[model samples]
Target chain A: MKFAVVVFPGSNCDVDMYHAISDELGEEVEYVWHDVDSLDDFDAILLPGGFSYGDYLRSGAIARFSNVMKAIKKAADEGKPILGVCNGFQILLEAGLLPGAMRRNNTLTFICRPVKLRVENNETMFTSQYERGEVITIPIAHGEGNYYCDEQTLQQLTANNQIVFRYEGENPNGSLQNIAGIVNEKGNVLGMMPHPERAVHELLGGADGLKLFQSIVTYWRDAHVVTT
Target chain B: MYKVKVYVTLRENVLDPQGNAVKGALHSLNYREVQDVRIGKFMELLVEKSDRDIDAVVKEMCEKLLANTVIEDYRYEIEEVVVQ
Candidate 1:
């Protein structure tokens, strides 16, 4: 399967995402510019972390209006897997591809460290390799990773099994319900603040995150084989 | 021409960490009377006269880009400008 790593001007993690996919995952991956209008050639889309548009206006606010968003939304509607990490998660929230919004960390400080996360649901394509209730270590770096949604929306998310990852211990950023990550209602789109791409190799620290990529690839291969 | 001033603020129920920090500082300075401090953003836009209604245009701008309706509420004031 092929992957497209969308890169905005201020995106610093594009290279990291490309390296993880190409070198570690041994997959076909390319960096697609934020202004590009087509993603038809790619099967999966990855939005990596960074302060897109310098976090101007709000984190990921301006970047969401980029020309590439049209294509990204189209890809989302087509049921393609899309994983967003860190600021990429912020963009997904801003673009309305996912629900809720992000707020400044309750401490009003930039947090940069590894945190434990529990796999709330492993049924989705992104977390199929993980076991429910399993805890894994992934690094988080951000100033505005606090996720917020209305009470009714929160209820819907809980009912739909959209909340996929929860903080294992102390809530690092004050996210509601200790939410560390979530997928859209369809389960095809996932947005998480933790950097799974950064953890794809043991040299980086832990290889726990490698399974997330493997799960996506496995799901795609199985589905393709079934249909064709 | 019109000079529009837009103010965007977090919704009432949403937590404002920066605002709370500022409020704490104010309380420490003996301004205990201040019960709440909610910080927000202010943006100024110079708009040219157009066929579209100014109120409608401003509202659309705020709803679409200037502020995210999910967590923020926005208000604006417009003043007609006379350029000699």
Candidate 2:
């Protein structure tokens, strides 16, 4: 399966994502420019982390207006598999792909550290390889990764089973219910504040990120998605 | 013309790490009594539409891009107006 990674001006994880998917996972991967208007060549699209658009007007605020995001929205509406990590997650929230909004880190400093996350749902294509309640180690780097939403919406998300991941311990960023990740109702789009691409190789200290990519490719292969 | 003021804030359950850090720094400096601190965004919008759907348009803006409803709450009001 061909995977496309969206690269905005300030995105720092596109290369890392490309390496993880193409070099390590041995799959076809492409870095799609954020200005591009189409995503017809990719089966799965990844929104990697970093301060998109220099974190102007909020972390993901400016990046959401990039031309490529318009196409991303179309693809998402068409039920294409999409994964957003870190700032990418913020962009998704801004783009309305997922629920909630991101606020500044309560402490107001750039936080860069490894965090433990618990797998909340394994049915989605991104986390199917992980078991429910399994803890995975990944790194989070952001100054605005705090997620928030009102009470009514929170209840709706809970009843809809939209939440998919949570912080394993410490509730690092003060995310609602310790939420680390969430998926849309269709389960094809996922946004999370942790960087899965950063933890794909053992040399990086943990390999928990591999499961996410593996699950994506495996879902396409098993389901015969647009067979070539 | 109508002027709207938008207040954007993080939902209560989410952590405001930045605000907490600032609060801590304030405490260290002997500025106490600040029980909690949270950071939010404020925006002023100008609209020329005279239709009663101003609220709907602003709501759409929030849903489409202005604010993320997943983890944030946003409220707006037409604070001023001139029907020129």
Candidate 3:
């Protein structure tokens, strides 16, 4: 499926996302600048990680006001799959596309390493390939990756089964409940701190992340394929 | 002219690791009386006098951009400047 990787001015992982989609996933992908006013041509939206707007005023705070965000919101309203990684996840939170906010890592340092994550729910489009309770290795790199939300919101997330991924062994960033990834109420939008694109190739590290992209493509084709 | 000063800090329920680290350093330095230390942000804005309500304008700025109400709290003060 065609994907659009939204690129803000300070986004450093845009190329990595593009390479993951175009080369590793072998899918059609394009870099959509932050100023773009429409996402009509893309089938899915990918918000890559980086210090957007230099992480000024807070991570993803300034970037949330970018012109492309309006379109991203509209895309979400239209039920198009939207996946946000790292700072992209922070942007989703700042833009109110996802619940919860990111805070400084409990250690107060920039952490960059491969983290083991447990797939909490495999029913969604993003994790359909994985078995329930499956564990996968993905890399996470961020300073403010701690996720915080009110008790009510956390309960709602649990009730709706929106929690997609959780830390397998140790909570590296001190995220609430060890939540590493989550999907919106509608299940079309996902926000996660780990870098799945970075783990798509075994040469780079491991190919555990490739299944997520494959799941999305497989689910899309299954739902959209025309029956004559 | 008007000078607007804004202060932003993490919400009470949120943990401030930097602030905690600083507090620890202070304790090691023998500052025993210190109860707590919270780090925050400060910004100053200069705006030209206009018919619009300055309070409303600054409030909007703080709500929309100056601070993220989800995890941080913000307060601001406006002062009139005299021009010679």
Predictions' DockQ, in order:
0.82, 0.50, 0.82
Model 3, B8-40: lDDT tens digits are 999888888889999999999999888889999
Clashing pairs in 1: none
Expressed as tens digits, the lDDT of each residue in A131-168 for candidate 3 is: 99999999999999999998999999999999999999
Q: What are the lDDT figures for the candidates, one per model? A: 0.94, 0.85, 0.93
Taking chain A of model 1 alone, its TM-score versus the true chain A equals 0.98
* Model 2's TM-score against the true structure: 0.81
Model 1: residue A82 alpha-carbon error in angstroms:
0.5
The digit string of per-residue lDDT tens for model 2 on A3-36 reads 9999998899999999999877899999999999
Candidate 1 lDDT over B7-84, as tens digits, reads: 999999999999999999999999999999999999999999999999999999999889999999999999999866
lDDT, model 3, position B42: 99
Instruction: State interface RMSD in Å for all models.
Output: 0.6, 3.1, 0.8
What is the CA-based DockQ of model 3?
0.82
